[model samples]
Target: MMRILLLAVLLLTVACGTVTPPIDIAPDAWISYDHKTSYFVSDAGADSVRLTVKYASFTFLDKSAELLPVAKSVFQRISNELAEKRGTVRAVYDSSKFYESVAYNGVSGVSTALVSNELTFSAKADSSGTPTSAIEPVEIVQKLEALKKALDSGLITKEEYERKKKEILERY
Candidate 1:
């Protein structure tokens, strides 16, 4: 009977381990994001920004060896509005998003979230004095449009949209 019980426990562990993380667990870029990915931003003061990234509980990393280029895209967009912004991006893990999140991948049924870590990137201002932006940057207007789309699709609550809208506008 003891042997049977041990076998049962082993099976359970294997089943639980079957749950895969949404992002590639690469040594180089363990965390990644894409155009579909969205995150909340707030001013943490000291020229530091706080980003609430969503992540799957099944696959979470307290620290990744390197920051993915895709994640850096978020910083580039933010720097467009706050040209003077400086400091490293710090990631903090929290269950808040897991509690508050109603989002999931329809195809895989995996939750989306940021690994939540701080990374450092320096933004260099253009000397041309022209409005042209580096291709890495996304315009505020575009972000607003995306937020509206999420609302229209019922992906987020009206209150969430309003709060994010305010946060984005406040920085610029």
Candidate 2:
């Protein structure tokens, strides 16, 4: 009877064990998309600005109504902050997501193209806004050199090397 009880407890424990999903870390230049919203953060001068855009289905009228105000409020707050910093934030609001690009003088701004079927808007920046492309020239040169070496060593094809080289140059 004790053996049966022990076996039952072991089975219960095994069955109850929960497996958690791994957390995702956002990349250096891109922000992680949340279930209801996607946001990007950029630094301008000494200040950092976050641009958040919420998503909701248009078919769900109640849900859309609920989320629209929240998205507007968040956008307003970010716009106010940027204006205070003498910065500009541009965002495109589609039915599902908000794609944003923010630019400010004297600071690194996030600049990304936002395309939507409904609307497009932009605010100009005084300074060049290409933080992600601000990779060290030396590093890019090194990577190019490495690619060439790979081609020479027959580790990669000439076509692959050229494609990678073009991609590297486009970043600048």
- Computed on alpha carbons, the lDDT of every model, listed in order, comes to 0.44, 0.45
Candidate 1 segments exceeding 4 Å error: 1-35, 53-68, 82-172
Give the per-residue lDDT of model 1 (tens digit) for 9-88: 87655433322333333344332344444444555555344443443432233112123333344544543434444322
TM-score for each of the candidates: 0.26, 0.25
Error of 1 at 167 (Å): 39
**Residue 34 in candidate 1 has what lDDT?**
41
Error of 2 at 157 (Å): 0.5
Winning candidate number (TM-score): 1
Q: Over the stretch 24-107, how does candidate 2's per-residue lDDT look in tens digits?
A: 224454333434334444432343333443332323122333444555555554454444455433433233543432211112
Q: What is the lDDT of candidate 1?
A: 0.44
Off by over 4 Å in 2: 1-132
Model 2: C-alpha RMSD to truth?
16.5
What's the CA error at residue 104 for candidate 2, in Å?
49
